[model samples]
Target: MIMQSLRGRLFLGLTAVIVLAGGLGGLLTYQWAFDEAIEMQDSVLIQIGSVLQHGAQSAPAETPLAGVDSDAEVVIRELGTAPRGAVADRQLWGFADGLRTDSLQGRPVRLLLRSRPDGSRFAVAQQTAIRNEIAGELAFRALVPIAALIPCLMLVTALVINRSFQPVKRLAAKLNARQADDLDKLPVENAPRELHPFIASINGLLERIRLMVDQQRRFIADAAHELRTPITALSLQAENLEQLLLSDDGRARLASLRTGMSRTKHLLEQLLALARYEMGRPGKSPLVSLDQVAKDVVAELLPEAVERGVDLGFEIIEPSWVRAELVALAAMIRNLLDNALRFTPRGGHIDLGIYRQGEAAVLQIEDSGPGIAPADMARIFEPFYRGGRPSGDGSGLGLSIVKRIVENLGGTIAIENIQGAGLSGLRVTVELHHECDARATGRQQAPAAVPAES
Candidate 1:
């Protein structure tokens, strides 16, 4: 049988303890019984000796045969065969001598011996059969109590061990009754101290899993809700184009339909990017230059900046590199710059800079625009969360994507208002672990400038 369960193991352990204790007790009882029986036998022998000596001295010399009794047989034999100076016999001699004594078998016998001077006779008397019976009774009595107690003691020990494990049994029952969705903390009171930590840790892991599952569920629902609108819009536009295909008004309607389709596509691309960031499935990371990423984002967004008549610029405070996924870093920088350019008014300035501060590489972006309110600042990075109504067309996903990418790259992002930047734009600072300086020799060449447009 499998003995891996708690009940099995506990039963085996309790059984072992019971058997050991009972065996030890039985062994001690047996030893005591033997010792007691031996003691009783010695007393019987001494009494027989005393009686034989008394009878021998009391009997007349002329009445030697008259004093012969079966009860004293043991003593008479011992006296007759005893060595000249011997005080005791070397072996147990039964009541077969000329002396008799009380026997353990409940009979009596007489004992007789000859005095050394002039061949005078003496008599000893004892009940030999009664003495033997008493010895047998004593041995039986000693064993009876132990035999009676063994089963009772074993039963009581089993009960005690089983009672001691009740708490563990209760815990198992409670755990088994819980539902799969129950991520609540366990009740630890009255639990064994050794097991409490394990229960608590399991509960902690369950709680984290519950939170992640909830987050994923919410993200799916939101994504579906957000995607439905654009899909409906595209469908309506297609239907309209199909209905009005033969006139000048149809051409205008088609242009409008194309614009709606383009916007929908952009939204879908942003949604896909968010999903990818969440899933962490953009393949393996590689080494990339944060400064180069910043330049590339600026270059890609330069046309948008020019269309808005905003001045976008970047500065490299340190020549360094970091190990990361190049595409993820580019996406993160692109989103941040996009947000800045979107918020900045025409003629407003957007500055992006990379520098090393101690062991961290810091990327700071400052733009001239309306800064976020204090209450909205804390949750700006949450997915699909927009800070009030945004100043320009936006999907409210830019900061969320940037946050996820930075986290995946093992970096941190912080934002605050830049008060004296003329326009009320925000300052976002991202900090990454600093890579080894590539220009420690003080003669390193500068990287070629990347154009504001690819």
Candidate 2:
């Protein structure tokens, strides 16, 4: 547990040290104060005895002093010349003229005995328990302030520690809020001197990673662009070969070659598209109509849906607008529709939606196709990750491209396996920040019903 948290360990260690030091200091202070109090009280007893010895002849026999009374617990007793009082007084008379501790009436008392000029003796005494009580009270009063100050010191220590860790917390927040492609160096200004080295190290690492990613993206883009020409030329040559008269088996082989070439061309095209989006920045965010983008993508792909006997159309389209680059928005919608059409089986249907909900503009695509498996759901958006049930002529880069575009546009995408009675399919939902129209009211218009294309 100590290894898991630095703040916990520091706080606990400091608290223990403070408590130990404070406790030891308090013990020493109490002892010193108690001893001083005991000495001061002894002096008072001696002074009282001295005053009585000089004044005992003028005062009445066995009478209390004017200032000092019984309420003060000072007892003055006159013993006859031969000590003819109680057993305790007789015991006091046996001792020479000095202070002693002896039991008076079975209770401990401190006594100071002195004789007058006429040989008459008087004793001044106070209870041992009362003397000790006063001393202890003084000692404890000294401890009260220390006791109060310890907790206050602890509170101040905690506040200072928390304040000192604020820069670290703020640094973590900045890193977490950064975009995927953001590899900017962390700022060291205003941070603690101790953290400057750590921040510099992190900035160096980010710079290295940014350089490495740039190299990889450039390599892919260059390779795909270079190979596109030769692949197209080979496809043209195969098309030229189709004009020659050949046997039935040769014709069958040519068709297979054409299919392989087409698949390769598709793969290269996908690679190029992925590289372009990853390397190119979406410069400015402009207000674009989400419904119009989705409509255009649907129209472009409608012929493929017709050829495969799949019904494709918009189920809901509202005049929703979002702040995103025009090309990015079109690419996001096109990839989504392309993936849906490629997966949806013949005679199945693909539903499209674009509407504004609250402060977000949403685009949804649902297709009547085999849903993704539970195991593959986690990696479905990863580049080139075709699942176990890989179907159709998919290059597996469509969803990855869409995810990049959506992220660049500051939007979110969610994929879920649709489940119901006698129905199972996939649903993809994207939500972007809605750009409200200043000319219209706050409320959005109802969705326009569009019929499915044959």
Candidate 3:
């Protein structure tokens, strides 16, 4: 069967208890009344016997007892068989049949009698209407109090149960009134202690959802702002190319248009990559080596470094291993290295180092370029936030993508300017949780990195 709501269910349970109690109480009351009636009847019988015994002893000896009814005469005759001075037999069998017969017929009677020396009996019989009257009155008196209390008991039980359920009802109403965006923590004061943990867990989930929604909104706004300039540049360049035929500057305009298109494509690709990094795939992370990732990134950028006459170097600080998605780790390292290469002056030097620090594996990239100003350091990791409009050749999403990847791997990334180390470039550091010996040995065989496109 379909279950009822909380209020109805509680009412039903309490009503059942009340009904059971009422039934039991009624049964008990009936039993008590029945017992009292039996006791009263027996007491009346005993009193009648005592009165007859006393009358038999006190009656005048010479006069015949007149006005004795047939039932009383029979009892007196039986009593006359007893010795005069002996105690009367208290056994009720002799008169029990007559008493039951009289009671059934609604003819109540009492007798006083004694036996004479000649085996005859004298007796006086009286109608006992008062006995029946008292019994009826006592039954009415006993039942009246109990009958009055039943409704009162039920009313009191209902009130107590209703008061006890008030908190649950209030909680339900409060929840029902809430809106979808209402992610604030619930007010738990005066709430049932049993429901507190459930409320707390709901609040936690809502907080996470709110944070994610806020992040998505920010990402969209920043992506639009970043794409706007490149798109506008491409559009204007196309228009200029269209008019170049009249000015005999078609070839130059075509080159500029091509450059604009390239920039637009690069920005779009970066946006897609950042989106993919944020929407991470669910699975077990593949085994990856920090040393191999560093090597691949350095090898991919070697040609550019050579053309610029800049020295690019990689050092393995610790022969350790990590578990991560290889493609994601490569992208993360490539972005950081690409950023360094784009900004560093020709003939400058760049160093990539991988090492273990405590329980973490670390990657440090230091480039000999113009260092970031202290004021602009914090915003450098923000998506599409270029520092002071430097060369437009680089999409500002590089460091942001790097940060995102590091975070996805359960790692942290930080940047700071190197001081007094014969280099003025920015130093970027990434830290990842490393596997211990048992897990590391199981995946000791290194997988080859996918070679980067030329």
Candidate 4:
């Protein structure tokens, strides 16, 4: 079960073909060179034999080149017509004048026999093994170029294949870097011709998805707006009914009805916020003091914290400024505090912090409540995802709204369960890039915390 990458498969197939062709061509080349070398050696033997027959009368009875070296092993000797010599020499005298293979001493040799006008027979011979060794060396030399060429061909092929696939890699990088709401058409002007069809298909799919998302946002926003009027009217009517006298049981039921209506109204409000932040774009952000925003949000929510007997205050505050919308930033902070208040039990505490670290402005919120379940952590930011332990009259859209606002401002939010040191709760931390110095704005510094009355 090997994963077949296109590039890998192409390289392997081409390399195999190159090796096969080189091997076959090399085999043919070696055989041809070997045969030619053997023939050239045979021609040398005939020349020597001719020289011996013409110069025999002037020279000694035997040639001085006999067993001179391993390479020049030619032997020359004259024999009378009566065949008076060793068994091997006598055997050669019986043969006709031409080239022939015979055994001399105990090893095989190639012989060229001839006769003069005097009727004396002579022979010139060399060992067969020495001739073959010379031929093999010549043939091997002919194969060096082909042996070197195969690897060079394979290397060039690899480089070409890699260069050709660069466009695909660039396309993937562009897609990966895009924001979630980026639905603009991709540019095809500079892309390769082979990728034009693929780019067009992707652009078409993006257009369709953008349209569907627009429709969904419109439906949610429109429905919430339409329902607000009736919900307000009903709440006023229920308040007016308090003027009439009622039994204890009836009063209890009326209280429940009011709670239900309140919850419904909160849910509708959250839905409208989510739709607005999701579909609308942030344009021309201005610098705002992050600590000031946190203080304002905490001041507004202090009365509710006091009513519930919860200690809610800023643990640390520093002057930090960020570029973002004032309204959106306040909403983000308010939603986080509201979520913390809903889960924190009476006598429990909530701590808020705002500070600067390097080029980033950090906002952190920690609450003393039951920590999130391991299973629910993955979907905590999803819309209407109430955790395993649903608490209070929560609409389950607080975190979703906060997340949308955070992302709209080009910031990041991380949520994790607080553990160790005998503490257990949820901590949310957000980091935003700093814009400018807070002291340069000439605004008055606000207090870190506004405690509710006892």
lDDT digits (tens) for residues 1-454 of candidate 3: 2136665676677767766776677667766776686456645444544554554454443232344323322232243443353333222213432334233124555544434345445443344554445555666567676677767776776687678778777877887898654656877776789778877887788789878876885586478567767677776767676765545476676777778677876777677677767655478787777777678667778998898878889755566577777777888888888878877888888888888899999999999988788888879888888887366688888888788788778899989988995659889999998776735356753455554321
Q: How many backbone clashes does candidate 1 have?
A: 53
Question: lDDT tens digits, residues 1-454, model 2?
Answer: 8646777777788888889989999999999999998888788888877777776444544555567534446667777688775787788788788888888778998888888888878787788998888889999999998899889888988888888889989988999999777987998988899889999999999999989998999899899989999999999999999999989999999999999999999888888878877875746666666787677667778999999999999899988887766666777887888777778889999999888899899999999998899899999989999887887688899898888878777789999988999897789999998878722644332123222211
Q: What is candidate 4's lDDT per residue for 1-454, written digit by digit as tens?
A: 1227888988888889999999999999999999998898898888777776786352344664643454766667677666986887788888889998877778888888888777888887778888788889989999999999999999999999899899999999999999878998999998999999999999999999999999999899899988988998989988887778988898888889888998888888888888878885647777778899898888899999999898999999998888777777888898888888888899999999998888899999999988799899999989999989988788888889889888888889999999999898889999999765656766433445432211
lDDT of 3 at 381: 81
Give the higher-TM-score candidate: 2 or 4: 4
TM-score of 3: 0.49
Weakest lDDT window of 10 consecutive positions for candidate 2: 445-454
* TM-score versus the correct structure, for each prediction: 0.48, 0.74, 0.49, 0.75
Ranking by lDDT: 4, 2, 3, 1
- Ranked by TM-score from best down, the candidates are 4, 2, 3, 1
RMSD to native for every prediction? 13.1, 6.6, 13.4, 5.9
Error of 3 at 148 (Å): 48
Count clashing pairs, candidate 4.
Answer: 0
lDDT of 1 by residue, 1-454 (tens): 6387665676677667766776677677666766676455555445544554554444232232233333323333333433332322222132243433333223334233324343323333344454445555665677676667766766776677678778778878887898654556888887878778878887799889878976885586478557867687777767676776468887777777766766665566577677667655445455566777677677778889999999888755555566566677777888888888878889998988899888888999999888888889878987778888575457788888788778777799999988863548889999987667544534332234432211
TM-score of 2: 0.74
Q: Model-by-model lDDT, in order? A: 0.66, 0.82, 0.68, 0.84
